[model samples]
Target: MSGALLEAKGLCKRYGALVANDNISLTVAPGELHAIIGPNGAGKTTLIGQLTGQIRPDEGRILFRSEDITDRGMPARVQFGLSRSFQISSIFPSFNAECNVALPIQAKAGHSFRFWTPAVVIESLRGPARELLGRVGLGERGATRASVMAHGERRQLEVAMALASQPSLLLLDEPMAGLGAGESARMVAFLKSLKGRFGILLVEHDMNAVFALADRISVLASGRVIVSGTPEEIRSSREVREVYLGEEFDA
Candidate 1:
């Protein structure tokens, strides 16, 4: 609790002949924004899956707030204050934005969806759901159905839903995946505003957003971390330049 908010030590995952994540170790300090950048097939997805309990590591330990949770399932992890947002938007197409977030709020409150009533109709769930929608810059769009919202707005809805559980550590996998320049900039600003409030482990491909929002960065290549350091340090690293950023990184 006093040290790293989330710690992964010697994490390894394998699939027959291929090693997805090899001895991966990283620490995200309390309220720190840590970014993971890598090329395709660099095992970023595998590592994120292991962290969120979607995939189990072949060998390692995962600690959250000083407690080991290597074996916890996804739901258990969410209950323990670890929440994840996927690369693709996961929202209820038929539900309004407020209802979408309220469902997670209900889930986090240990409620069952046995009732046929909509989540937004439940006064108790609607208040906090609306608050979450405002927190993610969707305050005015609460009544917009997911099917009618733009792609970027849908992604914002996903984040609001993730936050409905009040997670201590947020694993964001490519929040900027399919956004246009303006949308991406808005998202980067939103994430920047969240820095120091959440211990964020961001797996992103947008180098501009990554460098702008990350407190520290880790570069993964061939299923292993090649370097982890501050943005300036990473930018100057010859290894990162050659393998990922390339010679025209600054240009």
Candidate 2:
């Protein structure tokens, strides 16, 4: 845990009388994919909000690269190589896939977006944008408008934009949400290929994808982490099965 890419300790969030997150803690090691899974309203999203600086925890500490970031804002966190993709795809609908990605690259390069220079003319931003798109399996769709791309492709583009920040740890929220079987499979394969390149904290409801991609998993129930362990340990956990995985899971 000394060199953990991201660490959260005793995070607690409250909405008046309701407890959203209760002493939630987890760590993502460099190049490790850690999955967080639980039923709805288990405080997974609240926990992610705290980690991403969108929501302040009433009690907790967040550290990125061994530096305390609990007080840091979203931009500060991104500057520290922490990036995230939301469960809902956010992209520039009117812009081509390349331009959408280029904006973030441009921002990271300290360039003004107000400049009239066309994205195609700015080879510096365009070059890396294309590569990031390629990494997300959207190479051929770079010229396609984001609005026209399928839901899965838009998800990929959003991921490409996150990569534009060159994050050391990427937090993904429900990457498989709203995908059909084929699209889900594609996303699974894409995520599988990213193993060991960077640290990833994934919050997903897709059990198949979670088991396939996670090096370790943390199960949340009623705003608390019920278990945290390797995939095999989680699979063999009777409590996890009973609380979430259901009776069909062979203990």
Candidate 3:
């Protein structure tokens, strides 16, 4: 509560008899990387959906930078420095990587309607887009078609697009969804490098990557948060093992 950049208090959502999120509460401080992990159907993604305005909670409050955003739509949230990426690729695959990156910058700059004009001529949007691609280690691939780039690099482009708005907080839903071994390693390295630059709400299943990157880990089971602790504590938690990992998770 001291300096929370994003806070979800008493969040609850029900789909018929299935409770996807039940009174879930969490706080992410400025520039902290917070990860949420759990077994399938544990409501990790549901909570993320509610937090990002994809879905509404039956009851709760969502505060961003001390402002209430529970009623805010996705675009409004983006305007307020809140950005998110989905588990699947959401970029314009037909466009060049940099073009996809630049679109968001243009959108954020209130120029999406002027399709006939050249966005590159506008320095306000173009400059930040280039810088974002460079920051994500894709400076040289700016002209590459997004559909032709490697999967790992496309994911990096997705990140670049997210950063186009200069978000203060990022809600990443399974950033490593279909990455291979080497690609996953590369993603892990990149996220570790991004550790302190922005507050992140990471929902992932890769425990190896989670331990390597998260400042704190929150575990959930059956639509409820089991516990939240440091990597060391989570690694040794008997309850987590028995509930999610079938008694052999940590053995």
Per-residue accuracy of model 1 over 1-251 as CA lDDT, tens digit each = 54999999999999999999999999999899999988889999899899999898999999998899998899999999999985344688998998899888988887555554664347878889989999889999989999999989888888999999899899998889889999999999999888899999999888889989999999999899999999999988988988865424551
Candidate 3, 79-135: lDDT as tens digits: 999989753457877888777888788777775546655644455555677788998
Ten-residue segment with the worst summed lDDT in candidate 3?
Answer: 242-251
Off by over 4 Å in 3: 87-89, 111-124, 247-251
Question: If candidate 3 were superposed on the true structure by all CA atoms, what would the RMSD be?
Answer: 2.5
Q: After superposing candidate 2 on the true structure, give the runs of residues whose Cα lies further than 4 Å from its correct spot.
A: 87-89, 111-121, 245-251
TM-score of each: 0.93, 0.93, 0.92
Model 2 vs. true fold: TM? 0.93
Tens digits of lDDT, candidate 2, 159-214? 89988999888999999999899989999998888889989999998889999999
